[model samples]
Target chain A: MSAREISRLVVPNRGQSVWLVLLSASAMAFLAVFALALSVTSAQLARNWSAALAQTATVRISAPPEEIEAQTAIVLEVLRTTPGIAEANVMVAAEQAALLEAWLGPDLPLDALPLPRLIELTETEEGPDRQGLRLRLAAEAPGAVFDDHTRWRRPLAEAAGRLRAFALVSLGLIGGVTAAIVVLASSAALASNGQVIRVLRLVGARDRFIALAFVRRISSRAFIGAAAGTALGMLALRALPEAGGNVHLLSGLGFSGAGWLLPLAIPPLAMVLAWAASMATAFKLLREVT
Target chain B: MIAFEDVAHDYGGGPLFREVSVRLEPGSFHFLTGPSGAGKSTFLKLCYGELLPSFGVVRLMDRDVRTLSRDALAETRERIGVVHQDCQFLDHLSVEQNVGLPLTATGRPLREADLSDLLGWVGLGEQAEALPPTLSGGERQRAALARAIIAAPNVLLADEPTGNLDWEMSQRLMMLMIELNRMGTAVLIATHDLQLIRFAKAQVNARVMRIAGRRLQIAGADL
Candidate 1:
């Protein structure tokens, strides 16, 4: 049958199950948007952290105040001579003081506190061998410790990866729940309109024709609901207070540039899901009726 | 054409009818009469592929109903129109849409002129906009008839087509069936109305068959 004609066969207000489907679709879309944003942001954070920290190391020189400058020079010399170390520079005293000011009060006298000297090292792509660097530092500057940031970077990167995994899993669960709701609602609609289906079949309506009527109705509803939910989700994300300068995770939790198009895909995906669920339900019910 | 070869059906409550065989040829008119619960509806269902024969074969247009795929069966059904006693309809649709349902179902574009003509033919021209729930029993029956013939099927099966109509309406409906038969459309009407059978016998060359004793037999010299 023509879609228009077949559509007219179902009473528009016959069942409330469609509302259940709409509600479920909207809820799923809302959750899915957030999940998608979380996953994308977490992945970006992990990538940034890995890239920024993977080829760098730090050298801390703690010695008697009289020997600090000499040890710092020794650490720099060792790093510059290393095969994979690209550059090494001692941090300025003011920079070291600023780093310690957060722990001590800003008014403290920095130079009198016997602060350790810090050296920043930039390594080549094939970075320095940590064991060799540590042995060299221990002999030449007994107080020097070589830290490649693995202890800190590993945990932060792992945490971001876990968050990304969790968000993806949430998205999958939301999709599954949406599909389940659509199937249940479609089955209820089929049962409620059992007589309509029977009449259509009696008039020689093919299964495709009957299923088209239902699939179109359901999928359209899902699309509308998902579109609304996605819009609201985007707005909610927009309304969040701007992240503070250091809160990279919060700043990365929403889309930018082409990433805005990702949420738009949710509505169409919802329609496809609803279409499949409704078609399967209609054909199965029609089979049972016959 | 519909043919039954020793067809039998059971509802798991033991067989309702067994070893029943019949064939409906093109341009033929048949009256199936039987007592209540004697499998008249069951027989019609088997003829239309709504129910499969438990022990034998029922074929529509030379294809065994059992072997026809769901789509094939649907295609076959488009050529065979059926009218139930209940005059089932999508209650939300207007009478006009219900009457033109066959064409709609077959994906044929509905012609306003043809629908007007068919409704006028069934005496429902004025009631075309009425919903099924608002229709009288006789009006419903005429609408059902109009729906059954909208596609101009090769075979028309009506189960108690005039069961809910007055005598005059019943006669009017029967005349329409006879006209369809004369136009080379095979007709099958299952009814217990002896008077309607008598009325039909006088207007057309029709065979009256009775379902009794778990068998189908042509009643000789009955009317």
Candidate 2:
């Protein structure tokens, strides 16, 4: 039908559960935004952690204060001479104290503690062979232990990957729930308007024609409600404190730059979902009644 | 053009009508009359493809009704107009919109002048902006008639169009049907109102059929 003509046959909205559809769509969109944000942020964190830690290793030398300098120099010599070692440097006392402050508080007496001297190692593209490096450090620099940080970093990266997956699964569940709610609401609407459908059919209205009236009504509502929810979600995300200097998961639970555009698509997707739900329900009901 | 070939319809309990053979040719006018609960409405439904015959084939526009798909059935319905006994309407809509629904369904453009003329002809011009529920019994029937013929269907099937109207209103409705038939549109009206049938026969050469004892038969010149 012509747009003007179809507009005249407004689906009767009285007593139909339209509010349920709107509320469900809004709630779904709201949760979808957060899920998307969480997924994006976790993905970024996983990438960053994996990239930063993959090509780096640490050497800790523990010995008497008089022997610490000699052991550190010997560990650096061994690392520098290694085949896959790109660069190796001994960390200054101040740098070691700053790293230790995060764990032992700022007021700890660094002078009296028997701290281990640290050597940072950067690997080439082929990376340092862990087995060879460990054997070399044990033979030449017995006081030094090679640490790849994989014992803890790998688990952290895996946890970030799992969080991203969980967020994606939550998003899918939200979409499925939204569709189910819309189906129920549209079915209720079709049932309540049984007489109206009969009249339309009697006047030679096709099933598609009758279905368009209802689909348009419900999809428009979903679009409006989803738009509102998306806007609110974006605002809520924007109001959160910036990640700043923190290195934790909760601090990174937000979007940045082009990532904001992802949530903008929710409204249109909700509109399409609502249209399909209403169209299917309307045609099914019309078939039984006509 | 609607044709029934020894069609039989049953409601699972028993057969409501059997061996009902009839043909509605182009430009013909027919009146279906019978006593209460004699399956007049069922016969009308069969003619409009609303109910499938249980035993034999029914043809609409020369195609067997059984083979017509859902979309095909809808397309066939566009060529036929039906009015029910109670005059069903989307009560939320105004009378003007309700009358123009056929054009809307068929995707035909609405012309203000044509709609105004049709409403004026049905004597519902004054109630054009009023809702269907706000209209009187006669006005609702007239509006229903206006909607039925808005697309200019080849055949019109109305079940008890005057069942709820007064004597004056019944005559008025019959006159509208006669006017439509005079314009070469086939009309089949199912009703028990013999007086209305007699009034229509005076204005048009109408064939009268009656359903009795679960069968349909052409009525003689008794009335």
Candidate 3:
């Protein structure tokens, strides 16, 4: 009865307070995986959606006003007739103006700046043959140049991949740190209860009974800590402002639908770690005194 | 039952006790009287398997003290009850819980009423839930006695069980030990109180042992 009661009294009153352990575990859990969550999802979105951007190429025809319309028509015709080219559309003046406005100042008059004629090409299911398409376009409209967005996409995707890897490494480091802290906490608790153990032995308590008290206490404390940390982590993620180029990537980091329940697992998993570590430490330290 | 065989003990290579041997039988009481630093407590520690003899085999309940595992040692302790001169109580626990410690520790479930009745037997009915630190000297001794017999251990070992108690309280404590011996519990009292030893002999057959120069010897006295 006293053993069971001692288990009840472990964190909140007796040794390391429950709130402190819970808070510490929660902090560790949140920090451990936060970077990983961001990196992995960002990498996934980048890898999965990059093909959509890569499927089609755009042509810009730069020439005099009279020749601009002529070159644009010629580029569109080349794209439509080329093998692996499914569709083509010469950009309307309004679409070109909007695209330019994103880079240039919004107040710039589109008529004042003699912007180039742009033609968008769609690749067939078989995919566009880049060399053939480029040759055809150059022969038809010498002023037309193809842009496949090579320089931008490669670096972006590579950066996303690196971020994911970094996140995973961070998660692993956090786990190691958590284990270290738990080991220290368990050891301290075992030390503090040294006299209690001696008394228990004097009263004829088996080592197993004495060990259970510590294992249960530390485990329950870790569980509480992880739960609070996870809750706060979710809350902080939800409160962040999402207005950037990778808004979808940033916001999409968290679980959705059935995946939302996955985050709830961290507490029990942490408890398991605590139980194992504390149980082992308790028994080992108990071997000396009892 | 305990047997000490040519036991020699040393701390930092300085002898606390050496070449000592004693066999204490069932239903017997031994008073190990000595001045301070005479190894009375050391001899008691050896008897209960709290400390192993450095040179000899000390056996409790027919098992080598040093050979037993932690759990085995715990089970061995179930057959022994030790009360310190200070009556080392877990001050946070109530008087009843303190007395019931041995039972709880050994996983021997005790009924609430029985626990209450045991406290009543010790005449601490009013202080049953009171903390050990708050108990008077006599109450602490009685509580210690209650704890010693709560599991009905075969051997009861006390280091000056009534050193803090007044004369009448000491008499009551001695009477309790004699009663336990009458019921076949081998009781060993380590104290310098000759009066208590003399009082013990009047009720039950007791043997007197003395500690001098780190050795224990049976004394030539009425006890």
| Candidate 3, position A237, lDDT | 66
lDDT of 1 by residue, B1-223 (tens): 7998988889888788888888999999999999999999999998888999998989999999989998899888889889999989988888988887777766888888999999999899999999999999988998998998898899999998888789998999899999999999999999999999999999999999899988888888566
Tens-digit per-residue lDDT, A134-225, candidate 3? 78777888898988767667887887787778877877776667676777787887787766666777778787877886678878889888
Report clash pairs, candidate 3. Answer: A11-A18, A22-A225, A26-A225
Interface RMSD, one decimal, each candidate: 2.1, 2.3, 2.9
> What stretches of model 1 exceed 4 Å from their correct place?
A1-13, A83-87, A107-112, A123-131, A244-247, A250-252
- Model 1 agreement with the true structure over A1-290: per-residue lDDT tens digits: 36475564554554788798887888889889999999988887888888888888889888998898888888888888889999887889888888888988789988777777888889899888889889999999999999899998999999999999999999989988998899998888888877877887888888888888888888988998999899989988788766643337776577776998999999999999999988988888878878
Please state the error at residue A50 of candidate 1 in Å.
Answer: 3.2
Give the range of the ten consecutive residues with the poorest summed lDDT in model 1 chain A: A5-14
CAPRI quality band, candidate 3: acceptable
Q: Mind giving the per-residue lDDT tens digits that candidate 2 earns over A1-290?
A: 36455554567765647788787788889899999999998888888888788899899998888888888878878887889889988888899999989999999999898888888888899988899889998998788999988986889788998999999999999888988888888888777777877877777778888888777878888888899889989998888878885434676677877888999999999999999988888788778875
Looking at candidate 1 chain B, the ten consecutive residues that score lowest on lDDT are B99-108
True-structure lDDT of candidate 3:
0.78
lDDT of 3 by residue, B116-214 (tens): 888888889999989887888899888888887898889999998888889999998888888878889998999999988888887777899988878
Candidate 2 residue pairs that clash:
none
> Of the native A-B interface contacts, what share survives in model 3?
0.57
- Residue B36, model 3: lDDT of 90
